[model samples]
Target: MFDSFVFMAPPLPDDLVTRYFRHCLEDSLFTLRRQVRMARMSGRFGANDETRLSLMPMILQSLLEDGIRDRLPLQRVDPEWSPETLVIAMHLYSVEARRIQSPEETRRIQQTFPDIKTPDFTSAEHTGQLREAYIAARLAALRDGTTPTSLSIGIEL
Candidate 1:
């Protein structure tokens, strides 16, 4: 069942895909939701890797198109906002999401990449709250005249 949902990228409308990303972020199932997010951004999957392509990248790409058409909030906050910035944010969120959802896998990942910093999601009660905090922090930094780096919204929250 989980495999079906993760592997099949239906021909969902752009709006629906965007909505699905939000739902996935809020989903309680760690194995599916967090894994999909992490896998999508892990850079191991090529553009043609449909079996590995999860919903996060699809929706994020769609969001970038929408942002180009209708100016995303990050754009208003910082005129230099690009899709790469959003992708980086997604990657950070995925790292934290995987940590919160799958501790064992996260530990293995940490051991694999010793220098990589992972967020402390041990106490988080909701993934959405953490995502909101990240976005809020980025926006705050941008509004304060600080050039919001890809990691300006660190995993502090």
Candidate 2:
């Protein structure tokens, strides 16, 4: 599910970052869950953790800038809102959302939302939309000053 496309030559760091961002943005909830689980199971973030860490902030910043250029409502309307902050918030939110959950908590969540069908991550098309909604809710909370940080992970965004 996380296959990289071939290119003419060695892809630039920026190219890799762009691809990663796009992959995250386009991933299904199930895919995200699987990815998060696999990462945790590996017991290390990645062999290239240092490289990824260095590139992620820049990638996120660029993605946010692109969003701004496209006139997407990525940031709160409040004048005090910072695009950089919003980018970080969005990145963290996405990461945590897909983080592995305890079996007990997963069962509890399943019980709590019995009516909502579990999303199929393999082929679902609206995961990006769902993720964007999560981001939007975080932005709304900030805009309203209802929450100090954006959101708590397990609340069913």
Best TM-score among the predictions, by candidate number? 2
Name the regions of candidate 1 deviating beyond 4 angstroms. 1-125, 147-157
Worst 10 residues of 1 by lDDT: 64-73
The TM-score of predicted model 2 comes to: 0.25
Where does candidate 1 clash, by residue pair? none
Q: Worst ten-residue run, lDDT, model 2?
A: 120-129
lDDT of 1 by residue, 5-36 (tens): 55353332345334434343333233343444
lDDT of 2: 0.37
Instruction: Give per-model TM-scores.
Output: 0.19, 0.25
lDDT of 2 by residue, 1-157 (tens): 2333232223223443344334433333334445545665688765344343443343334333343223223443335536655455455535434431334534433333222344422221223333333334323323333122233234544
Candidate 1 yields a Cα-based lDDT of 0.37
Give each model's whole-structure lDDT: 0.37, 0.37
